[model samples]
Target: MELNGVVSAWLLSTVKVKKIKMSKQWGQKAEELEISNKVAGLGLGQKGSNQTSDTEDGPDAANPAEASLLMKIIRQGLVESKLDIEIQRKDPNSPLYSVKTFEALHLKPNLLKGVYAMGFNAPSKIQETALPTLLADPPQNMIAQSQSGTGKTAAFVLAMLSRVDATKNYPQVLCLSPTYELAIQTGEVAAKMAKFCSEIKLKFAVRGEEVPKGTKITDQILIGTPGKMLDWGVKFGMFDLSKIKVFVLDEADVMIDRQGHQEQCIRIHKCLPSTCQMMFFSATYHSAVMEFAEIIVPNPIIIRLLREEESLDNIKQYYVKCKSPEDKYRAICNIYGVITIGQAIIFCHTRKTASWLSEKMSKDGHSVAVLSGELTVDQRIAVLDRFRAGLEKVLITTNVLSRGIDVEQVTLVVNFDMPMDLNKKADCETYLHRIGRTGRFGKAGIAINLIDSPQAMEICLDIEAHFGKKIQLLDIEDAEEIEKIGA
Candidate 1:
């Protein structure tokens, strides 16, 4: 859901503060001070702000350096506390919201078992609100806007599974994704959820999958990309659309925004039975996409779970100041030296840039993987497998890896080239998605924006303003500070 302009304006006015100070010479002692302040900020006042050092004099009173550090710590604490409080205050509670157990949702016994086996204790906010509406007797169409990693997939997957008649396996459900990788991933999730339901057959119609000529698709569930789904449905006549009961458009915003995808999706939708339940899910909802969705999904129960400021609250965003393009490269290397990053993704603006950076970083003794549109499907899959298995430490790529791919161990993201649209203006939504690659499943993550020019810096500021949050500055020259910041 889009943020209300008035609410975002109010949040910016109140919570926007100067960037936090980073001490260049911060050692073990300074680290302790920062931790104490952070604890105090979180309401654990174990040590008072004015406590004295072991020298029988207050640290701030005896040493000017320590004093400056104390003041900065206090300022940082106040800023963080106020931001948290304001976000909590501005979040409006929905009347449809309720806390319920998976059993209470009345899911199929096998699906419920799968849910427990997957370790889901209860329904997420989206699932809580969407499941009942989606699984209602008179099947309803739904257009849901939720943040990444918010269990939107499970919600719809459950709906699809519940609607499918497993006894007769003849393609009762169809799901479409923007990319082949995403389609495969969604298919895997659905398969896992239907583990106990062995009768439910699934088929993927993405690239590289060959369906024999004149072969009827007997799979009860089909998940694939729009282009391939359309090809099989219209050209090959492989699937029976009249019997399909559920149709889902995962990552609906991306599909609608791309050139041919929207048309192909519409064609596939037209072929479906009029009684089919259509469900659309996306992290973003552009005005044009929403208008198109409205036309396609009749009387959809709209569920929006995103607020402007709280979208990126779990991510700690910072920008490294670089003097030149060469300096940006040096900064990248220096970052790896300072922090123990699990798995990081660096975003470049172009495929050329991604390839260049990957090669350079490899030369600099860093194992990096590159993914872009230029890579073939097999190459992309191989790279992703290596990265997911913890074999690769860094991935340098363009916008291809930006949306809908979840890597839990990815704790760091670097925007080597800030996202910009055709007009060269900061594409705020793209930036959000790029950073969102990390910080999955409510984990704390860091996103670093590498700014080497005035234009890049301006773009960073624009993103900051757009999110109503200040981007902290990182000095790459200071190893100690960089370690603390990365930590």
Candidate 2:
């Protein structure tokens, strides 16, 4: 669903990632999704080797496009774009124009080719709604509230690449991610899309990267963290800020919270010429972040998610009543796969717990991976890469990794410890993003919270009350009840 890094389901039919050996269970899940997606009119995309498809088929489809289907999965929380046709819209025509497929965008031939090869058969609901307004000439600024699997990364990457002038041989676009890991993830998606744009050079301005002094920085696209961008663009005179055409802040909520990052981001924004287009994206927008965003991106076309979509109703919420901290280990193993399933993610409150869980799970002969703030940027990327390759069945980490990690096979998310904010209050937003890692696209997913104390139970209850969604008590001892998760 995040297809953020995971390939789209229909396109997965033709994508052959060499090292990843998906199990029969994985194949079955993919097959079901491929079938269901086709029925929804999202057929397969192009495989690199094959250049032609019949008028109605993917280049490598072995079966007919009219194959029988499985149960339909609803893709919810579509984005709605209107600058003000609430009588004051940016373009009276924008709300009326939506593309069913990327082809309708009429992207450059090579750019479109990369899109198809990446397995994006059709634009996600958000993409179809937002791209039209984003790609229009004399670019319009935007502030978007979107969740994982809604195609926010791909949407912005498409916009950045579309506006780049490859022939200029200079940086035309700049994207700011909250952390080093997120910048790399967003870069991975952009690199795949710009594969065919031979002359477009994309650069990462993250930490530890070195550029020679006096060497002209001519990359057409830039993605990095705010501190590094400020250090390189301001402390040093490496970047030519005046020529930037488009500027973006991915995960603006976190950026606003990071100490000094808000000021650094603003500094970078001030250097850009007024004509530069600004875009701010985040899953949840707190009032502070909203205020910060408006200050940097003026008169933006704001996109809001419907209440139903924001509710995370697609993920079933359950809480286990555990007697002690030791019992959480048992609870995790018990409901991991009530039925044959894909990968899973487990969240803990601290790195000490994450390390302990990792050692325990590994000693018990389970294939698990651990990620925390302690990991270096490269270490975190490698951990996510292994998880995506299906080398690890479970990823145990803390809030540090919660906001990003968009693996498609993830079907289960466990709160090894309930999440809480700095003031010890239930963190409804963090809980949503944690479980949001699963249920990508439109697939059903399950989230289990292990409450080991009255405090934890109270925290769980607060979250339930905040979202107006019930968190049912789960009986781990009941087999039949557990098995119904996949149902």
Candidate 3:
């Protein structure tokens, strides 16, 4: 799911403030809250305290040999947590990869032809696990969680087409997304997959535009953003809720994250048939988002795969400790002398920071461009195109290109400001996605983190605990003395 911009830290700041207010009213210290009886009620507490002595000798404390073991444990924990929540298992010997074409999936002949034409042989991880469950007798609600580039788009599209009715075509299936880009992306994917099923009619809704005066609406599938879909419903008239058998929300979590758009999603649900099946897909889903999903879906068949190992294996993780924000700026300047890398992405906590950093980098004679939601969609695409074409060696942004968007030339990812919220408790999805931009398709990469405060160190430790990966600290002032003890 692609969000138009980064509001996670902002949203999390609000959540933190509210929590602090509640804690103060109840007169509870952070340590007290951590071990409170109420926390124990959540059934997430360890048998012993989560706290350990700072002097404890272990790999988590920066020793090389033990740190490697710490990473292994953290990786195991990530996989275990996901598996515990879902009932699916990984089959190394599954025939999915060996299968040459999707024809054996029992799809209609027209659909088979379309699949063949798309040049897809065999199925992706998402398609392999999700298809059979979706095609079973008495269809069930499904909740699929997989990273982007895993072909999740095809899995949901196929599910929608398989159940769509072509006889009375007035939009029997509706797929909603968060942004225009992702909505259009999903619509394009649906069109490609449905091309194999010749009988299915697909039409994307128009905004402030009507389905021509005398034209009959014969499309069996409708794909659009919530706002346009809602607008079309008010203009074109609502279809029979009873006949709409399938509903899919691509990038469901992001749709819910945008407060105004979420209302439209709920309204769509209200208009769907009581027996309609719903499926949701996304790479990063938070606790609040998952809670909202449970209320919307019925007995959903949840399938969450093991979190992919942090792509930092090849990337040298480094941190420069600075005394203040200004010190961080100086450190960034010094980095130019230490390493002349190909290209890099500097991430900030807000658009203001991104803009300021880009200006400073440019002043230092480095080619730089800034990306944020404040720019028009065309402007954003233009920046991306330039970066991909090697015209821009450095790009600054506020989590805009953290996920979904892939640019290969970027060999380094710099975190100017530590991400405040990793979102999920057990997995570092946001952190991994940011670094995954580099070191993609099995190439090497570098991730540099500039730490200027104690809170930043805390965030780093939490990320390390979550991913079980050690990010080495670097003293950029003494480049010759820098050590790779753990990372």
Candidate 4:
């Protein structure tokens, strides 16, 4: 039988064991059996008396390293199984909840084909809970929060495709993001998801995209930034709001927190049909954002997957204490030699700092790219494309690339200046989003907060208190110790 069947049988076999003694014995037997099965599955057969010996003989009796590896796998499997059970038990009324297969959700044939073509075999926890609520009759509004790279994009993209009336070419669905890069990324994903539905047209209203004046948007789905989207709707009169069936606000918290984004978003919302279904998604939401959401999306079903403290557990966070600004630079350069980083992002607080760092790094013989608001839209796109394609190894930027830019190979993030607001206080939200650029999809990552002064250290402490995570100290002098930090 397969691993799933084995897990199911193991779960079922212990259901009727009521007594504590019986339950303990069953648990032990189940663990041993599961471990044995996993060992066989890996083609690591129990070969000699030493390998096949009893558990009480301890891992030293066999290979100590192999025993440690097996224990780690077992613990990880138990954690995943527990999470799956908890998710299923939490939302029993959801039709898509606990569904193992996409076909079980009864999605449209085209959507199903798109999903499989995208290589998704099973529904993620967010998809299992949010899809049914999104696809329900009357199309209720929804507010979902999940960690970065948890299939939230796919969930909402599926919803948008499912709700669109492909027969109508007048912008039936609209999705808004905070940045041009993010907007373009979302549009690309939506296009891929709706590939089988060839009749479904998609439009992007991001910066630098030339939408001819007086041209009507005949696409079935529209994705863009709030400013550009509103510009197209109000200035160019490009969108037909009455025909819009679904509206999505990606990165809701960031969108609402910006200077004019809230007002622009409200204007767009006001123009949409009252019957249009609204969906909001983000990695984090403040109480104020939640209050605003209550007003924008009426009677919404909220699916929050992570609390503040529970988030970003997959990313190992640390801080390097430096004696001066020069020491900080030396520490950063030293890090490149110590860690095996696939890609690194260094976050500066200002464009000037980013430019200076970029120049300095390039002078030091590193392939680096600098991104900030100073660059034109086309320039930003080119830099991002090269970085995403792995042509650039280091990206130095301000807050522009902080949120919603998903680069899978970014294994290291350095908070060079430390994210701080105008009052010189720690900006927890930006800090979270900055580190989130790495650690995509539950992959292990490392974030280094370089601190040169007591104030910066205090700011790091505030961030630690905010997220309830410890920022371990790193000894820059000890190369071996730094190497083992993320390993």
Candidate 5:
């Protein structure tokens, strides 16, 4: 409510000053509420699950240097993406927070090295925030929403690792995935990250791998499909359900929506000790599933990144600031280790850049393939066939493969150049479709862009304005930060 000079004078004479001040405060509060509502109504979810400083995996807590580094990263505002994270903790006075790096989490020394060894120096937006809650001393259950391929596997894996006692290991951590492939994939990530921890062991409880009667299974972490876990933990009585410390239900949305998984999960949940840390991680959760989760896992820390549009929530997107084409190639080389976990699709603005990158990636000892509009239909088919068969981990191309391509294994997508239209404006549709190549079939995925020039920055800003999502900077020079590329 605006008052002109004459109206203000009249109000001062007619109304009490205290009443006028109260009215002004009410008007300001109303405007603030309207803005807050618009933001709250944004969509949700990000690439990876979150983490923070909770339980130390080993005796070595973070020193002053590490703590300083943590504060520095937070102060620097590093790794800023359009990931709007809202953390709801039961203790509002003692709120949980987001950490920028694993170093800040004060993890065990070996475990910290293992995180970096797994090519994860810093946590993704989700992992940084979600970890502390997962690792808190009294232990809190967490219901988290993150995109596929966002390092959620690693986040939960680290949580399980932090809570385990290798000396008394007998299946302390149990993770239930929805499928054999997902179980294997998660087991792979866990095994890789836990390698430096020495005493830690991970086993997949999928088909044809069951233990015979009277034999004990000693693996510290057990990952499996719901039915296998239910049978192994309940029917067979293989794992001492009471001894389990962490129970993770990955792809939980799918688990609940499936025909029989809900019952199996519930049966298994009933067997777990009250002290166990329960975690539910999924890309999307309907209100019904969320309600059910609330019933099963009480007092959970909820972290959500509001969604902007369709399928965008599935892709973890970032941009690298490069000075030249060579620098862009260097950025690719830096993240090559992380991107190779699954098949990758690197989109160039033109066929020349694609060909050049294909050559460089191959020369750098990567199994690379090329696809372009110049290729014959048969050639394109052959390239895709090789990529699908895992013969080529990296598929460099122009925009030809942007649409009608659904490779479940493609977890990484690289935009070596910004996308633009014929008028040289940002090509919002093509840009969306290009990154959409990854994060397909409800799987997690990562997308990176290289902005080398002022024009490229302009294109990125235009794309940013189009979607109302920020394209945060990625520094290839920082080895620690580089681990976050495909996370």
Candidate 6:
């Protein structure tokens, strides 16, 4: 009400007075005021003007910066509040976002053709914001802090792919990931996305796994894990990074978190061309990782999505708090009876628990399979393929399948073992990706977090706090409910 009253006062006053009135009206009634309150409700109430002065003063105001700090806080809170500001569609006559890319940067024909073949209609949010800085005259290095599933891959991929020259192919782009699975996954995407390049053949370097028994490193795009790629680059004497146009540290946070791999990443950076464009992409950013990235790409355009929480509209996330693990297991069985479940991925924290749960489920006569890092590539692939093909109803695994793997048929995700981090547990992105296997391509899906422990309760609390949505819990002790779930 105080807010509405202030807005009302502003609307009645002159533009200059409105600004002063707005500043003075904070923490006062605005919604419940005179008939002029209707003016406050209008869409055209000096958007962004209210905090303009605050932003200009920034952190250099009176009190040796304390006033500026206070102003900054006020502005941030106001912006995030989604109050007083009006949102309307852009005028149709107005131009859309600017076009900035390889063509804008004056790249050659081969690179341009590759970009067209990637099936990109235009730039995504990340691409639109970062391309100008990236494609600058001298090509400033980029430290992109964007969320996953928001097309960060395409931004860097296009930059790297656009740098490759079809004529001379000697591994132009080098991408480093944290794990072998992620490396292979990224390589696959690079291969497919770059398949239309025709001239650029991307290669994957897997340790102890020979590439067709006689594959060479003559590919234009080379993606691999740090250890394997570095080892191969050194062994094959093929790392001539001096001529490399792009160096990408994909998932920089994960890459550097390894015991000593951060130093290795620095070493790899040192090998790159002095003028090469370095790009870093990560879903979450830590201070240490950001500092490390500063060494590789100084003064990077920090592109933030600025979303308060992840979006899980396509994913139905719920929590089932049970008295014990057995009760939680029974709840899952009960829910299965009510819904026709497609391929479901059950997330467990440990291999032992995963295997034990699988065994117990098998005794209950569920067509279940288990997956963990212990599984060989072939074993994992077989399990994944079977699950994808709908041969298996549920497969249990750890975080290995968390980030990159996407199976369309997975309609349900059961968090049998709650995630350790609540911030991550209820994360809409991870939640979407987890339950995304089902309700894919506009299909409806469901995710159930089996909260059978104190730890699981904490995860539930975090989910509630993160999404600001309450989960409906079902009591499954009833015989009818138990029978339905078991059936």
Clashes of each: 0, 7, 5, 0, 24, 15
Q: List per-prediction Cα lDDT, in the order shown.
A: 0.70, 0.71, 0.62, 0.71, 0.70, 0.57
lDDT of 1 by residue, 1-487 (tens): 0110111111111122234445633453364454334433433212122222333111211121122222222222111111111111122452343347888777878888987776677787677778887888778788987645567778899899899887785889999987766776677778788888787778887776766666778888889888878777766677777888999998776565445676677667767888999999876666666667776788777876444446487899999988866888999888888888899999887666766788888998888888765555457667877887888989987655655466789999999888876466787877987898887777888899999888898899999998888899988899998888765
Q: After superposing candidate 1 on the true structure, give the runs of residues whose Cα lies further than 4 Å from its correct spot.
A: 1-99, 107-125, 146-154, 164-244, 257-259, 268-274, 307-323, 331-345, 355-373, 376-394, 403-413, 435-448, 472-487
* TM-score: model 5 vs. ground truth: 0.51
lDDT of 6 by residue, 247-328 (tens): 8887776565554455456546656667777788875565555656665565455554454333356666667778876777
**Candidate 2 displacement at residue 201 in angstroms:** 4.8
Q: Model 2, which residues run further than 4 Å from truth?
A: 1-96, 113-121, 147-151, 165-171, 179-240, 307-323, 326-346, 354-397, 400-414, 434-449, 472-487
Candidate 4 regions off by >4 Å? 1-98, 114-122, 146-154, 164-245, 257-261, 264-275, 308-323, 333-345, 358-373, 376-395, 403-413, 433-448, 468-487
TM-score result, candidate 3: 0.70
Per-residue lDDT of model 5, residues 188-207, tens digit only: 77777777777877777776
Please state every model's RMSD to the true fold in angstroms: 21.6, 18.2, 13.5, 22.0, 22.5, 21.0
Q: Model 4, 76-163: lDDT tens per residue?
A: 2111211221122234574443456788778889889988887777877777778877888879788887644567788899999888
TM-score for candidate 1, residues paired by index: 0.61
In model 5, the runs with Cα more than 4 Å from the true position are: 1-81, 310-487
Each model's TM-score, in the order given?
0.61, 0.63, 0.70, 0.61, 0.51, 0.59
Q: What does candidate 2's lDDT look like per residue over 211-238, in tens digits?
A: 6555567788888888877766656656
Better of 1 and 3 by lDDT: 1
Better of 3 and 5 by TM-score: 3
